[model samples]
Target chain A: MRYSGFQVIKEALTGHKGWKPVWRDPEPQSHYDIIIIGGGGHGLATAYYLAKEFGEKKIAVLEKGWIGGGNVGRNTTIIRSNYLLDGNEPFYEMSLKLWEGLEQDFNYNAMVSQRGILNLIHSDAQRDAFTRRGNAMMLNGADAEMLSTEQILDRYPFLNVNDARFPIKGGLAQHRGGTVRHDAVAWGYARGADMRGVDIIQNCEVTGFRLENGKCLGVETSRGFIGANKVGCAVAGSSSRLMSKADMQLPMESHVLQAFVSEGLKPVIPGVITFGAGHFYCSQSDKGGLVFGGDLDGYNSYAQRGNMPVVEDVCESGMALMPMLGRARLLRMWGGIMDMSMDGSPIIDKTHIDGLYFNGGWCYGGFKATPASGFCFAHLLSRDAPHPNATEFRFDRFSRGLMIDEKGMGNQPNLH
Target chain B: MIINHPLLGPRDAAEFTYLGDASLINRPDWQSETAAQDFYEYGYLRSNPAGIHRELWFHEAGDRSWLVVTRNTVTHEISNVEMARDVARTQGRSK
Candidate 1:
């Protein structure tokens, strides 16, 4: 798990290595000016940005578990901004930009390798859709390349190469898109923020909140009560539960997403690849293991355990796409709860409550959006207004039919 | 054969369904059964179950958590077609 810079970069190129935490707080703090109720990537990123942007110290990130213990630590770390939806496109593009400059910005090695992500096209319809998406990326100054079947095979000789069921007609490759160390992102932001006087309270769960005159005064945690001028709930899985205490209902649902890793072998996959026809996606880890994941567990459950059907489905897709992986033994599998929004996008907006802010509903692709989401959420929290790109991601959009329904899958809780 | 259930579409139309303990719909009446037989003889149910078989389905249970259905075409044999809830419940148990 612990990777050096060279190993991290190399593993990132192959989609193989993950970040091992290098720092931990020796003592936990009791209070802060701002109490963020999750230690995932978003919470840590928000803390880092809050300290960096507002110079507001005494910020405490209270987590029921360790840093990166939530979806931040358990995600397919493929980073890209190839969004076609209006509201999400620009915001994700900003995240991609931050990914490009992350190492220099944080002075921490995130191992953000721009190895390119290829969204394979299975048919002419898919190709046309990808064309529109590629054009949009180009218009937004993001790098994208449309490739033919020959080009795909030439670049990736290890693929099955041909199959009538799901032919590899072509694909859209974002040259600037790739994978990163998911845990390192959380730690990097946490370390950077901690150095700026933010208190990261691990193993400290926020049990409830204290509201005074329609405003969030502070929170009551397992450790004790802590007062804060502003409180942001960045807890991805527990967003609705926390918000419900304030008589607010988020257009959010908590669903489980599962990921798996195959036993280590010599690296074969060179970049992150997604099968548009199937739910499977994969990138080789730094240690030569195949790291991959599939769609969310179709049913609702707070339990972080996934069933065999999805594992079988994803593995079958992987085997069909890469026949060589048939012999690769799956070493382990894990699941994390995701706050899937109705629109499959995040909600970075202030609630009707005066001091209560929210940054959640990341669905499954939150790892890549961490930096930008935090930056935008921090801006909103500080200014009490929406960020430029996130203006349409308001909490009230659902009521006004302004939902950003990406993937053309309406704002259904189970669709994402 | 395409077995058409009331709640669910044709059998093939269903991605997968759950089999349950009891039926939700009653058997067809005499006239409807005769018509169904005629349709089945004409390759309606023979080719696609959706043409003749009337299946009882319980929506809102299973993997997709929609419904349970039962369909029959020839002898009118009814059987449940839904993901086993116990299996899902067992699978959902935390490790």
Candidate 2:
């Protein structure tokens, strides 16, 4: 049913008996035309677009665990398009546009709140950098505004403006960027894809690939061997592990990134605030809890939990940004395994193996790039060519020396 | 996570910078015939094991020494630590 105020009121009056499960829990079929591994936000959205836009048939999404059990449900849930690089700016801007119309398109309440995102400046050099970044964003058809220190203070008065080490200078605000209810995004995409006759099989893990002479035919799964004509893998942090089954190595490292939420308080933060000097970014949830995160735990591990030092480091950065944050008690903390690439960007390209496509290395940007990643991935899978916006995210970019090093931090996955 | 430094005593792993696979220190000769392929393998191909692993960590906050830390990836337990310079010397490298 198409959800609306009328539907809510009608359901409330009629005991809500007509409400249905968001998506059907179906068993995996023997064969599929297109099989997508990892039923996270990107996978589900990819299946949704493949059927909706590309008119592909017999699509199946196989999730090792429950839908949204991965990073889709375990992220800080911020979204933005304030990118500077030519290869990245257009792609992220496309994602922001998709996020803007996502709820209406999918007929779900994702709560895509465009409350805006502010990146604080702590020095003259940062202001200059953000100035260039804002102009680049605007040139890419995305909204950006350079806010003065007084304007930033006016918007977020709780922030500490007078600090000896890292003084507050100014900010770059993207008024179109904001947060969404992370879980609902998964549910919405799953429902949309299922409605189009795509099967979403949960509790189904891919064990290996079914290959013949360097061409992938299907996958061997926990349930059994599920046959497919083509397979697309979007298993984020598990990219290397899964691809290794095919004896392929990726230029990505897996690291754990932790996020924290504070105890609920009165609404104070108007929107998202990112400290420029450090690696902390925060946004106050609708429930009045401040949700934030920082750098990844610097190691290669598949573990979802992180160590204490990174936690302390994150809290220290948050405290540095806003000393008032000290009063807010941390309620909960969790970690997501990030597929950090060599150049600190993502990779979405066909691998050396035929009929096998890969989409990963998203690192911290995976959550925000859900819609566009799925859309462009679907474009690539359907057309067997790079999308107009994602030409730089190729497998050979490293060898070709066309790395999309956004942070200019060369080759270090942890620093990115 | 704490790494018991060979010289500086027990230190928090946070202060140390992590790099994957201490085997990276063994740089293949660039003048060799298979240098291109060797460098490709050296630069990109590295094993990511789930159990015990020997990796590199720089004591950036301490004495600026590179360390070879042998730790379990699954349990986060450190079993051994040695100065990477010493380890490099054993591997027949200088300067």
Candidate 3:
């Protein structure tokens, strides 16, 4: 069933009578080809690709919450491939490519609007850094352009042309980067994968790992024990906890990142804009509200509720960038738990255990990289060989001192 | 008086030093300064202000303790201003 945006809404309204979940084996199948823990974007996408690419139809994706109820649903859905490090550039570009063709591929209107993303430069140092990054993107065959102040103004006239504190310099505009409907992307993958006979189990939390002689055999969830030959851990927030239950620790910190939406207004902002000096970026939602977010609350917190500091900081920066937002009241605010890795890059590799695979450490950029991450992760899981682009993002890179420290920011929660 | 310089740029001098805490310098606003001072005196607050840059000191180690600072570049102001040791002690006591 190739469903579009309207069709999906209609189906939801009319009730999915014909659709039966493939994961519900009445007799309870003893095992599956692959078991994907966590039904977020990464896990669902992985399941989708496993069935679509490798022809592994007996795949199961188990989620603790309803589909699209995790960070995949909470994130500010911005997509970009303007990574600075060598290790991340190619893979993110691949993700960007997947994002480009996602709507057509899923037959779902993800609203993947490539309105372009502009990372504003504040200092001369920042300008040089963006220049280098833009050059790298160009060398890697990704679309990126450096815009001047006049060019920026010509493009986004609503922005403050003269702000003294952080003067408006040009930005690194990735033409391919943009925003998508966060929830729609998740539902699209769920509907698409479910159509291809993949079982998506919700309200099923993995309590423990079924290990036999140091190898993951299956998962013990709240629902029941499900056996699997291969198990993939795509759980983001609970990655550390799950791995610890298996007596392992990946270099990850769970932090709460918050996002805010302003009162609905006529759309003024066209593309996504990120501030270099300040931890803030915003995009206009289809409903005309200005959706934006800033740095994570600087403490180890699994609680999804963020403090007022981040919200105030984001709003202040928004006012600085576009003064018109001063009068615009904030409509709502929300938070998501991000698994911030030490290197700020994701880990897609076979774990120390033979059959157990892990895919996490997405930081705040997981929503946009859903397709590419899923594809590469699926390829790695199916072939037992890491994709060429994501080879450096191995779990052992931390011990080896080969960390891909993009943004020149350290792995510490406070810094990230 | 609004001092406008090329490097540091223009800012209202009246709004320079915070109103509540004179020990702390360059607080974002009166409300924030009061909040910080309230936290400092009482050792806790329901919530902390977001997105402000602040300079603080820690005094547990000695008469002059480690300075703790949190600031936001966009606002060009301090969000938190308190002693690191004080914060640690407060948090430790709470826990």
Candidate 4:
């Protein structure tokens, strides 16, 4: 059922019992026109767009577990498109735009907050770099502004602007970039796809791909062999493991990236603020918890838990940027397996095996890229061609020396 | 996490810096005919298995030596450790 203000008031008047499950729990079908693997944000969004926008039928999204169980629910929930490169800016800007209209388009409350994001500048080089990045964002039709130290201080008075080691000189602000209710995004997309006659199958693990003669026919799952005319794998964290079953080695590794939430407190952080001199970014949740995260654990792993070194490093950076945060008690911490691509960017393209498509290698930035990744991936699966905004996310970019190294960190996956 | 360094005994994992798969030591020959393909595979492709992985770790905050640590990716359990120099020598790299 479509939720609305009228429905809410009527349900409230009628003792609040008119709500239903967001999406149906359907069993896997034998065959489908298109099957999307991994029912995370990307997969569910792919199904939603495939049906709603592309007008495709007989679509299915297969999930190994419950929805919003992976990185979709494990991220710090920040979204921004303040990128510097041509290969990335337009695509992420498209994603930010989609996020703007997502809640209304999907008929769900995703809590899309455009409460601005500030990337703090500590050094002259970083300022120059972020200045170029701001120009690039504006050039790509996204909103950007350079905030002086006084302006930043006016907003975040608690920020340690005059720290001895890393002084905050200025900041690059994206007024359109902010956090969203990440789990509701999954639920909204799932409900939207379900409403559009797309099947979302849960608790079905794809054991292997049904490949023959250099073409994929279907997948061998725990339930049974489910045939599909086209299969798009959007499993970012386990991309390597899943693709290996098809005998295709991806140019990426999996690393554990951790996120943390502190005990609920007064709303201290107005929006998302990232420490430029270090690897820490934070946003205050609506419930008053301080959400933050930092660099990866810097090792290849399929595990969803990280070691303590990175956690200590993250807290140190947070303390460096905002010393007042030292008094806040951390409520909990969690990790997500990031499909860290070699060039530190995502790939959305067709694989060598016919009828088989791959969409992964998102590194730790998959949350922000969710909408565009799914839309472009659906476009590719339906049209068999990369979207104009995503033309650079190809499998052969690395071999062809067309790497979209956004952070300019070379082939180091962990650094990215 | 603790890495039992071959030369320095048990050491905290914080003392080390990670590079990546130990296979990187076997760099492809630049002068080979199929160098392009070989280098592409060598530089990008990864096993990234969920089980035990032999990875290179440099003891940046310790003895300043590289070690090949055979660790389980799923459980974060370290099984074996050896000097990367010895492993490279055994893989037939000569100066």
- Each model's DockQ? 0.03, 0.53, 0.03, 0.91
Candidate 4 accuracy as TM-score: 0.99
* TM-scores for the candidates: 0.79, 0.97, 0.80, 0.99
What are the runs in model 4 whose C-alpha is more than 4 Å off?
A: none
Query: Against the true structure, whose TM-score is highest?
Result: 4
Cα lDDT of model 2 by residue, A1-416, tens digit: 67899999999999999899878888788999999999999999999999999999999999999988999999999999998899999999999999999999999999999999999998888999999999999999999999988998888988888988998988999999999999999999999999999999999999999989988989999999999988999999888888999998888878889999999999999889999998999999998999999998889877888988889989999998889999999999998888888888888899888999999999888999999999999999999998899999988887767889889987778888
Give the whole-model CA lDDT for all candidates, comma-separated: 0.75, 0.91, 0.76, 0.94
Model 1's A-chain: what TM-score? 0.93
Question: What lDDT is reached at residue B53 by model 3?
Answer: 32
Chain B TM-scores of the candidates: 0.22, 0.96, 0.29, 0.97
Per-residue lDDT value at A56 in model 2: 95
Ranking by lDDT: 4, 2, 3, 1
True contacts kept of each: 0.00, 0.32, 0.00, 0.90
| DockQ-derived CAPRI band for the predicted complex in model 1 | incorrect
Q: How do the residues B1-95 of candidate 3 rate in per-residue lDDT, one tens digit apiece? A: 23232223443322232111122332234467466444332221111222343333223323433434454422334344454456556545322
Number of the top DockQ candidate = 4
Give the C-alpha miss distance for residue A86 in model 2, angstroms: 1.0
- Model 2 bad stretches (over 4 Å): none
Model 3 TM: 0.80
Candidate 3, residues A190-290: lDDT per residue as tens digits? Answer: 87788788888888888999998879999998888899999999988778777887777567666678989889999789989988778889999999998
